[model samples]
Target: MYKTQDIAVVILNWNGIELLKQFLPKVLEHSGDAHIYVADNASTDDSVNFVSKNFSTVKIIQNSQNGGYAEGYNDALQVVDEPLLCLLNSDIEVTENWLFAIIEAFNSEENTAIIQPKILDFKNKTTFEYAGAAGGFIDKYGYPYCRGRIFDTIEEDKGQYNDIIDIFWASGACFFIKNNVFNQLKGFDASYFAHMEEIDLCWRAFNANYKTKYVGFSTVYHVGGATLSNTSAKKTYLNFRNSLFTLVKNTDSKVFIRTVFRMILDGIAALRFLIQLKPKYFLAILKAHASFYKNLATIISARKEFPKRGNYAETDSIVWSYFIKKRTKF
Candidate 1:
C-alpha cells in the first residue's frame, strides 16, 4: 500500500499539545506514507518531549524561541525533497481522504503551487472556519475576503461549496503547496509572525503567477484561535500589520492611486478601538502603521519583484463587501 511518493506534512505546534493529541493520531492514520514533521515553537509545556516519547515515527523540530506561527513553520522546516508539502496547524482534525483529495487536485494542475481544503469550524460544525471558508480573494485595492467570510461575517458551510476553483489565497491552517513554488516565494514572511502570513504568501504567488486552488471535496475541522484569539492585542497587531504588508507588496502600478485611497478607508477600520472604547485596538493601529513605515524598504523590494497583476473583483453584492456592524470581537 506504500506508493513511494514524497509528501511531507508539517504541523506547527505551540503549547497546544492536548489539541494535537486529539488531531495528530487522526492525521497519521490517514497520512499513508507521507513524512510527518511537528515543529514545536518552544512551548514551556512539555509538548515537544511528549511528541518525542509517544510518536517515534514522526520527526520533531524544537525551536529556540517562540517564533510565532509563520517563523516556526517556515524556518523549522529545514528542507523538502518532497514533491508536495502541507503546512498544517495543530488545532485541526482532518478526514481520512483529506490528503488524498489535495494531492489529486494538485495532480490536475501543472503549475499549481497551493491547495486549500474545505474548512469547517469544529465547535460550530456547520459554520466555516475563521481563516477562510474555502479560499480567499483580493479586492481591487488588495483587501482580502473569502467565500466564508467578508469583513467580520463568517457564513455557514451548508455543504454548499465543494467546487474546485482558482483562488487568490488559501487558509494557512490546512494548506498544501508544491515544494519548488514554496521555496521560490521564500515561504511566509517571518515579520508577519502570525496572522495573514498565508495571504501574504499567496499574494507573492500572484506576483509570481503561480496557481492556487481550493479543494472543496476534502474537509477539516479547525478549533480556531489555537494560536491567537481575535480579541487579543497580539492578533490585532499582526493582522493589521500583515494586511498592510500584503497590500504594499502586491498592488500593480495601474491601481496604485486607487490602492492608496483604499488604504485610507482600511485605516478607518481601526476606529473599532477608538469609537468602541478599546485601547488595544488603538494600539494595534499605532504599531501596525509604525511597522509599515519602518519596513517601507522591504515593501518596496517586494513590489519591484511583482512582474504583473491581475484585474479581478467579485463585485460588491456577490462578495458581500459590506463593513462590519456592531459585532462582538472574537
Candidate 2:
C-alpha cells in the first residue's frame, strides 16, 4: 500500500510566479506528507529566488532551460525518487485531503498506472474545467473530449461525475502516475513540447496494458489557459499538430486511413475558422499539417516500438456525435 509520503507533488513552472504564489499554499496544506517540488523551467524572472526565500519547505529543481511541459517534467523527474508522482500544474488550487482518495485507489489497484482528480474551473467553481473535466477520452478520429466537456460546450457539475472510473487519459493539470510505469513508458514525447503529450503518454500506457483512472472524490480548481490562452493561434497550432502526432504514434488499426480522415476533419475546422474571420487560426491549422508531414517518418518509427491494442477509443467520431447529433454532454 502506498502512503501519503510516498507521493511527490511536482509543479512545473515557467516564469509563472504569480500562479505559484496563488496556489502553492493550498497544495502544501492539503497534500499531507507528500513532498512538494517546484520544477523551474529556467525562469528569467524572480520565480526561483522568490520560492527559495518564501517557501522554505518546498524543494526546487532548476532545469537547464525551458523545455515546455513534456521535456521540463522529464528533466525534473529524473531526480524525484518517490514511488508516485503528482504532476500538478502551477495554476491549480488543490483541495483539502486531495491526496487521500488517489492514494487509496493506487493501493487497491495494482494495474492502475495513472490517475487524475476532479478538475473544476477556478473562475466559476461550479463548472468543469476544460483541461480534464471528469477524465479524458478520445474519439476514433483522435479528438479528445471529457465527460463534462465536449468541444466548446462545458457542463455544470451536479455530482453526476462524482465516481471513480477508468479513463483513457489524465490531464497534465493534475496528473498522477506510478514512477515505475512512467519510466517504463519513457515519459512524455518531448517532440510535442506541450499540448496532447499527456494523452500520448496515457495512450502508450494503454498499449502496455496499464490502467489510467479518474478519482472524482479528490478535487482541484484549475485556472485554465493561464500560460497559454485559448484565443492564441499558437495554442491552436500545437493542439492540431500534437494531436496528429499522438494519433499516428498510438492509434490501434487502419493508421493511414484514420490519419487521413482526421486531417480531413481538421481541414473542415480550418475552413470554419476562415468563415469566422479568424485567418490566424486557419493558418495555424495549415502550419500544423505541414509540421505533421515533416515529422511523419519519425512518428511511424516510434509507432513500431510499441504494441498496438484494440478498443482504444470511446467513440468512432466525437465530431459526429457533438456536431451532427448535438450530443454535447459526455
Candidate 3:
C-alpha cells in the first residue's frame, strides 16, 4: 500500500513568488509526510531566493530554461523518486488532508494510473474552477469540458461531484500520476508547450489500458489562468493547436475524418468569434490551423509510436450538446 510519504507534491513555478509565499505554507502544513518540491522553470525573478530563504523544508529543482509547463515538469521530475507524483500549480491553495484520498485511491485502485482532485475557484470559493471543475471529459472531436463546466458556463459547487469516479482526463492544475506510467509515456509532448497537454497524456494512458480517475474527497482551489490569462490570444492558439495535435496522435481510428469534422466545427467557432468582434481570437484559430498543417507530417509520424484504442470520448459532440441542446451541466 502507498503511504503519504510516498507521494511528492511538486509545484511547477515560473516566477510566482507571491503565490508561493501565500500558498506554500498551507501545503506544507496540510500535507502529512509527503515530500514537497518547487520545480522552478528558470525564472528571472527572485522566486528561488524567496523559497530558499523562507521555505527551507521545500526542495527546489531548477531547470536550465523556461520550457513552459510540459518540458519543465518533464525535466524537474527526472530526479523525483517518489512513487506517486502530484504535478501541482503554484497558484493553487490545497485543502487540508488533500493527499489522503489520493493516496488511498492509489492503494486501492491498482489499475488506476492517474488521478485529479476536485478543483474550485480561489476567487469565488464556491464556484468550480474553469480548468478542471470536477473531472475532465472530451467529445469525439477532442473538445474538453468538465462535469461542472461546459464551454463558458460554470456551475457552483454544492457537493454534487464529491465522489470518486473514472474520468477521461485530469486537470493539469493539480494532476497526479504514477511515476512509472509517466516515464513509460515519455511525459507530456513537449510540442504542446502548455494547454491541453494533460489531456494528451491521459489519452495516451487510456490507449495503454490504464485508468485515470478523480478523487473528489481531495480538493484544491486554483486561481485559474494565473500563468496565462484566458483572454490571451497565445493561450487560444496553444489550446486549439495542441488539441488538434492530441486528436491526430491518439484518437483511435478515422483520424482524417475526425480531424476534418473538428476543423469544420473550429471554423464555425472562429466565425462566432468574428461575430463577437474578437478578431484576435479568430486570427488565433487561423494561425492554429496553419501551424497544424505545417506540423501534420511530424504529428502523423508520432501516431505510429503509440497503439491507438477505441471509445476514447464521452460524447459525440460537446459543442452540439452545449450550444444546441443547452445541456450545460455535465
For all candidates, what are the clash counts?
0, 0, 0
Clashing pairs in 2: none
Question: For all the candidates, what are their Cα RMSDs to the real structure?
Answer: 3.3, 0.6, 0.7
Q: Model 1, 1-330: lDDT tens per residue?
A: 112267888898888889778999988888888899888888888788888899888888878887787888777766556778888889888888677777777777687888899989999989888787878887666667788776667888776788899988899988887878888788778888888889888877877878889989999998888777877887888777787787777766655675566657646767756888987788887888888889988887867765756565444222223643443211
Task: Name the 10 consecutive residues with the lowest summed lDDT in model 1.
Answer: 321-330
All candidates in order of lDDT, best leading: 2, 3, 1
Give the 10-residue window scoring lowest on summed lDDT in candidate 2: 24-33
What residue pairs are clashing in model 3? none
Ranking by TM-score: 2, 3, 1
How well is each residue in 65-157 modelled by candidate 3, as lDDT tens digits? 999999999999999999899999999999889999998898897999999999999999999999999999998999999989998999999
Two-way lDDT contest, 1 vs 3, winner: 3
Clashes of 3: 0
Error of 2 at 65 (Å): 0.6
Residue 194 of model 1: what lDDT? 84
lDDT tens digits by residue: candidate 2, 171-267: 9999999999999999999999999999999999999999999999999999999889989999999999999999999988788899999999999
lDDT for 108 (candidate 3):
91
Q: What is the C-alpha lDDT of each candidate?
A: 0.78, 0.95, 0.94
Q: What value does the lDDT take at residue 301 in candidate 2?
A: 95
